[model samples]
Target: MKQAADPAKERYALMEKIQMVDFALVELTLYLDTHPQDTQAIQQFNQLAVESRDLKSAYEQRFGPLRQYGASFSGYPWNWGDSPWPWQL
Candidate 1:
């Protein structure tokens, strides 16, 4: 893939979808934990949780880490220095 591929749009879309899935998972988890007899709901919740994990991993791999983790990256003096905020897309 070319470095010129504009990932901004794709990145934003994925972020939105992931958030929705996360919210659903949280709501369903709380409900199902208290109501374990709902096998169908539990199954759907499990499937969605897996999808969410995969989406998060793919996003992080394509972009940078969602959160800075230790010194896993090399420091640079590129900008800010006066740079732009991430959402300036």
Candidate 2:
């Protein structure tokens, strides 16, 4: 039998992946600044950009906004206030 997925674990993994990708992108960008003609690095950066976008979208869909004002209000009576801090997760 297939077990159900844990939302908390899934979210944690997603966030961790996004951060790692973003960090890689930053490092690649710095390298490209010095080696502007590095096609391989440029291609990798493009791929990471697309991936980061998708991950952010998925995260926003499951959780609330990545930013406080990123999207329309969710939940009844302003649940954002009651929710745990983003860093807590």
Candidate 3:
């Protein structure tokens, strides 16, 4: 039998993935700045970029925008100002 999906868990998972990818991108960017000719770092950065975008989209659709001004209307009466900041989780 299939189990019910947990929205909170799913949101946390996606947020974790997004943070990981963002961290990797930042690290790779720093490395690329010094090693401009490193093709591997460039490729990794590009891959992470796509991953971050997809993860953010999924999270926003399920949960809500990471930023206060991030596309509204998906949820309803615009609760972007509500509690439960990302760090609070």
Provide the overall lDDT of each model, using Cα atoms, as 2-decimal numbers. Answer: 0.68, 0.80, 0.79
* Candidate 1 ranges beyond 4 A from true positions: 1-5, 67-89
C-alpha positional error of residue 68 in candidate 2 after TM-score superposition, expressed in Å: 4.9
Q: What is the TM-score of each candidate against the true structure?
A: 0.66, 0.77, 0.83
Q: Model 1, range 34-84, lDDT digits (tens) per residue? A: 998998998999899899888877765665444334422322543222222
lDDT of 1: 0.68
List ranges where model 2 is wrong by over 4 Å.
68-82
Predicted structure 3: lDDT: 0.79
Give me the runs in candidate 3 sitting further than 4 Å from their true place.
69-75
Candidate number achieving the greatest TM-score relative to the actual structure? 3
Q: Candidate 2 on 1-89: residue-level lDDT in tens?
A: 99999988998898888889989999999999999999999999999999988887787678765656745445555556645555676
With a 3 Å backbone cut-off (N, CA, C), the pairs that clash in candidate 2 are: none
Instruction: Provide the lowest-lDDT 10-residue window in model 2.
Output: 70-79
Instruction: Please give the ranking of all candidate structures by lDDT, highest first, separated by commas.
Output: 2, 3, 1
lDDT winner: 2
Residue pairs with backbone overlap in model 1: none
